[model samples]
Target: MKAAVWYGKHDVRIENKEEPVVQPGKIKIKVAWTGICGSDLHAYHGAPGVIQEGTPHPITGEMAPLTLGHEFSGIVHEIGEGVSEFAVGDRVTVEPMIKCGKCEPCKKGYSNLCDYFGFVGLQSNGGFADYVVVDDYMVHKLPDKVTLEEGALMEPAAVAFHAVKSSQMKVGSKVAVFGVGPIGLLTILCAKAAGASQIIAVDVSKERLQKAREIGATTVINGMEENAVQRILAETGGVDVAFEAAGAEVTVNNAIASIAKKGQVVIESIIPHPIKVDILQITAKEANLTATLGYCGVYKEVIAMVASGQLDVKSIITNKIVLDDLIENGFNLLTSDKSQAKIIVSPQ
Candidate 1:
C-alpha cells in the first residue's frame, strides 16, 4: 500500500507501507476520498494542538509522527469478527472519535467529552493511507443518494450541524456568523435549513463573502472594510444568535458583540491562544455563552440530509488533490491569499 507519511516538519513522504492488519472488533475501510482539514496543514508544519511533538497519544499511544487525515469516506472492504452491522461494499463515512464506550460521558451521550477521547488522525494513523482500521461503531453507512465525495465530508458537516443544534437556533431567528471558512460556510447552510430568517456572514475576504451569499447568507459584511457589529445590528435590528467560526480573538469578540438581547453566542472554532473576552457583553445581553467540542452521532444524519437535497455542501470545495499531489497542493494552501475552501484528497 502506498501511504503519505509525515517524517518531520513540512516533510511528507509517499512510499509503500504494509497494509493494515485486521483485528477482532475492528473495521477496515478502503479509502476513497479524504478531506484535508486545517489541522492537517498545521500538523504538517509542526503546529501546536494539532499534535504534540515527540509525545504519544493518550488513547492510541502513537507518538507525534502520524498518518494525517480524519474527514474521509470509504467502502467497508472487510469487517472483523463479531461485526455484523455492516458488510462488504457498504458505502460509509466514519465518526473518527475513538472513545471508550463504557466511559461516563459515552454512556451519557456526550462521547465527544470522553475522558479518553482520541480522534482518528490526531491520535492514530488515519485515512491518509490506503487502509485504516477503526471500531465498528465509528462507521456509518451512507444513503444511496449520497456520493463518496459528500460522504467524506460528513465529518465536518456533522460538526457544523452540532454547532447550530447546540446553539439552540429557532425558526425565523436571526444569526450572525463570524468567518467564512469551510466550517463557517457550512454553518451558514445549516442556519438557513434551520429556518434562520436573517443570516449575516462576516469575513475579511470579499471572495469568501460572495461564496457565502451563494450558499445561503442573507447578507455579508467585510469586517476589514466595515464595522461588523454596526453592519449586523443595522440588518437584523439585532441578531438573535451569533456564531464564532473564525477562531481568532477579534472575530470571537465580533460575534459576541453582534448578538441581540437574550441571544446565544456559539463558539465553534478552536481557540488555541489565550485571548481576552469581555464578560459584560454576556451579562448586558443576558446572552448564553456556549461552546461545542467535536460532534457525536451526527455523521449519518448529515449524510441523509445532504442526500435528501435539504443541504448542498459541494459549493465550498475549492480544490481536489490526489495523494501524489499533496505537497504541491499543500504549498498552494500555505501561500495562497484567497480563502479557497476545502481540498479533498484521493489517497488511492
Candidate 2:
C-alpha cells in the first residue's frame, strides 16, 4: 500500500507500506477518494505540535510518520469481528473522530467535546493511504444518490452543519460568513438550509466569493476591495449572526464588527494565535461570542441533504488528483492558488 506519511513539519512523502488489516470492532476500507484539509496544510507549514512527533498523541498514542487524510470516502473491503451494521462492498463515509466514550462530554452525547477527543487523520493512520482501518462506529453508509466524490466531502460538510446548528440562528436570520474557503462556503450552504434570509459572504478572493454566491450567499464582499464591515452594515443594518471562518486576525475582527446589537458571532476557524480584540465593543452591544470545534452527530443530516439535492457538495470540488500527485497537484495547488475550493485525492 502507498501512503503519504508526515515525518515532520513540511515533510510529507509517499512511501509504500504494508496495508492495514481489520481489527475487532473495526473495519478495513479501500479508500476511493480523500480531500486535503486545511489542517493538513497547517501541518505542512511548520506548525509545531500539530503532527505529533517527539511526544505521542494522548488518545491514539500515534506519533509522526502518520498517514494524513481524514475527509474521505471508500468501500468497505473487510468487516471486523462484532461488526454487523455493514458488510463487504458497502460504500461509506467516515466521521473520523476518535473519542473516549467514558468521558463526561461523551456520556452527555457531545463526543466532540470529549476530554480525550482526537481527529482520526491527525492522530492516527488516516485515509491518505490505500487502505484504512477505523472503528465501525465511525462509518456512515452513503445513499445511492450520493457519489463517491460527494461522499468524500461528508466530513467537512458535517463540520459546517454542526457550526450552523450550534449557532443561535433563527429562521429568516441574516448571516455573514467571513472566509469563503471550503468550510466557509459549506457554512453558507448550511446557513441557507437553516432558512437564513440573507447570507453575506466575505473573502479576499473574487473567485471564491462568486462560488459562494452560486451556492447560496445572498451577497458577496471582497474584503481586499472594500470595507467589508461598513458595507455589510450599510446594506443589511447588520447581520443577526456572523461566522469567522477565515482564521485570521483581520477577518475575526471584521466578523465581530459586522454584526448588529444583540447579534451572535460564531468562531468557526482555528485561529492559531491570540490577537487583541475590542472587548468594549462586544460588551457594549451585549452580543454573544461562541466557538465551535469539530462536529458531532451531524453526518446523517448532511448526507441526507446531499442525497436529496438540497446541498450540492459536488459543486465545491474544483480539482481531482491521483495519490501520487497529492503533494504537488493537491496540497501545493491549494497553497498557491486561493481560487481552488476543494481538491480530491484519488488513492486507488
Candidate 3:
C-alpha cells in the first residue's frame, strides 16, 4: 500500500507501507477518493496542535508520521467481527472523528466537543493510502445517487451543515459567509439549502467570489476591493446571521460587525492565534458568538442533500489527481493557487 506520511513540517513522503487490516468493530476500506483539507495544509506548514505530537493521541494512541487524509470515501472491503450494519463491497464515507464516549459532551450527544476528541488522519493511519481501517461506527453508507468523488466531500460538507444547523438563522433569514474558501463556499451551499433568503459571500479572491456566486451566494464581496462589513450593512441592513470562515482577525471582526441586532455569528474556521476583538460591537448588537468543531450527527443529512441534488457539492471540486502527485499537484497547487477549491486524490 502506498501512503502519504506526515513526518514533520514540509515533510510529507509517499511511501509504500503494509495495508491495514480490519479488526473487531472495525472496517477495512479500499479508498476511492480523499480530499486534501485545510487542516492538512495547516499540518504541512508545521502548524502545531493539529497533529498530535510528543504524547500520543488518547483515542488512536498515535502521533505524527501517520497517514494524512480524513475527508475520504471508499468501498468497504472487509468488516470486522461484531459489525453487522455493513458488509463487503458497501459504498461509504467516513465521519473520521474519534471521541471518548464516556466524556460529558459525548454523553450529551455532543461528541464533537468531547474531552478526548481527535480525528482519524491526524491521530491514526488514515485514507491517504490504498487501504485504511476505521471504527465501524464512523462509516456512513453513501446513497445510490452519490458518486465516490462527491462522497469524498461529505466530511467538509458535514462541517458546513453542522455550522448552519447550530446557528440561529431561520428560514428566510439573511446570511453572510466571511471567506469563500472550500469550507466557506460549502457553508454558502448549506445555508441556501437551509432556506436562507439571501446569502452573502466575502473573500479577497475574485475567483472564489465568482465561484460563490455561481453556487448559491446571492451577493459576493471582495474584501480587498471594498469594505465587506460596510457593504453588507448598507445592502441588507446587516445579515440575520454571519459566519467567520477565513480564520483571520479582520474577517472575524467583519463577521461580528456585519450581523443585525440580535443576529448570531458562528466561527467555522480554526484561527490559530488569538487576536483582539471589538467587544463593544458584540455588546451593542446583543449578538451570540459561537464556534463549531469538526461535525456530529449530520453526515446522513449531508449525504441525502447531495444525493437528491439539493446541494451541488461537486461544483467546489476544482481539481483531481492521483496519490503519487498529491504533494505537487494536490497540496502545493492548493497552497499556491487561490482559484483551486477542493482537490480530491485517488489513492488507488
Top TM-score: which candidate number? 3
- What candidate 3 gets wrong by more than 4 Å, as runs, is none
lDDT of 1 by residue, 216-318 (tens): 9989999889899988888777798898989998987888888888988899988887999998989998888899887987776787789988879877888
Model 1 worst lDDT window (10 residues): 330-339
Local accuracy of candidate 2 as per-residue lDDT tens digits, 1-348 = 999998877789999989987989999999999988999988888787566677678777887789998999999999999999999999999999989899899999999998977888888999999999999999999999999999999999998899999999999999999999999999998999889999999999989999999999999999888999999999999899999998988887888899999998999998778888887769988999889998998899999999998888888999999999988998889999998999999976
Pick out the ten consecutive residues of candidate 2 with the lowest summed lDDT.
Answer: 48-57
Query: What is candidate 2's TM-score against the reference?
Result: 0.98
Regions more than 4 Å wrong, model 1: 334-337
Better of 2 and 3 by TM-score: 3
lDDT of each: 0.84, 0.91, 0.93
Against the true structure, candidate 1 reaches a TM-score of 0.96
Q: Write the candidate numbers in order of decreasing TM-score.
A: 3, 2, 1
Better candidate by lDDT, 1 or 2 = 2
Cα lDDT of model 3 by residue, 170-242, tens digit: 9999999998899999999999999999999999999999999999999998888999888999999989999
Count of clashing pairs, candidate 3: 0
Q: Clash pairs of candidate 1?
A: none
The whole-model C-alpha lDDT of candidate 2 against the native structure comes to 0.91
How far off is residue 208 in model 2, in Å?
A: 1.1
